[model samples]
Target: MDPRSPPPGDGRLTPADLRLWAVLGLALVFLALAALFLAAPALGALIYGVPAPEGIGRTALRAIGARDAALALYLAGLALFSTRRAVAIVLAASLVIPACDLVLILSAGTAAWWQVALHGVSAGVLALTALWLARRNHSA
Candidate 1:
């Protein structure tokens, strides 16, 4: 076979492909959550146990929504247009968001245990997925 030719199994979907699909799904979920926050800032704030002071809460939630939306778009773009290495790098670096979220929620002293757990779990998953993707890409 020529060196320029595709790999033997190039047409087949592998486990890495499935994981990439899952990452895309996660990105969509983030986008949906962003929309939810944008549409219902009060509810979002309530869920996060953030103080939605009468005038400032809604504004803060909207800003958070925009930030989440931008993040989702970035993840989506990386997954769709970039190489696996780039996606892995972004996913790994993005762990900061969830880590900060967990810390902020804990510091606020209003979030439920479940909220903290959610952030922690999210960070773990993102970390693991990033490592897996990076290793797989390196091996490939």
Candidate 2:
């Protein structure tokens, strides 16, 4: 079979495409962010809308960074080596991250509107992308 002719579906908009670029794109994004958060927890917290952390608070940010890095590896690994369905399943499951972040940030009442909106939009996009991949995987 021609490598150019990817099997039908797999969530690619075109036959020549690999596991949707969105999956890989998101993975790369997370990886970059993970590095930033790991290297500079305070800055990462600020970017995430948290005020500059003090003392032990930085530990939590580091934990978040670690988690993000781990998730990024899993996502990228799946996109590269596993099936598209696996990527969709993982992406769908990962929705809890942004959803919980939105809720937590909102409940804290310390976040600006854009921060809250960012999380909300992230959750929305992840949900939509997961659904699109699933539906397209089934029908295309």
Best by TM-score: 2
Residue 17 in model 2: shift from native, Å? 2.0
Q: Candidate 1: list runs displaced more than 4 Å.
A: 1-16, 137-140
Off by over 4 Å in 2: 1-15, 137-140
The global C-alpha lDDT for each of the candidates, from Candidate 1 onward, is 0.74, 0.77
TM-score of 2: 0.82
lDDT of 2 by residue, 1-140 (tens): 67755456553343354445777778878888889888999888777877868888888888888988988898878777666767778889999999888787778888898888888887887787678667654443
> Which residue pairs in model 1 clash with each other?
none
Q: Candidate 2 local accuracy as lDDT?
A: 0.77
Residue range 26-140, candidate 1, lDDT tens digits: 7887798789789988777776667665676588788878878987888778777666667777889889988888778788998987777878888988897788667644342
User: Quick one: best lDDT, which candidate?
Assistant: 2
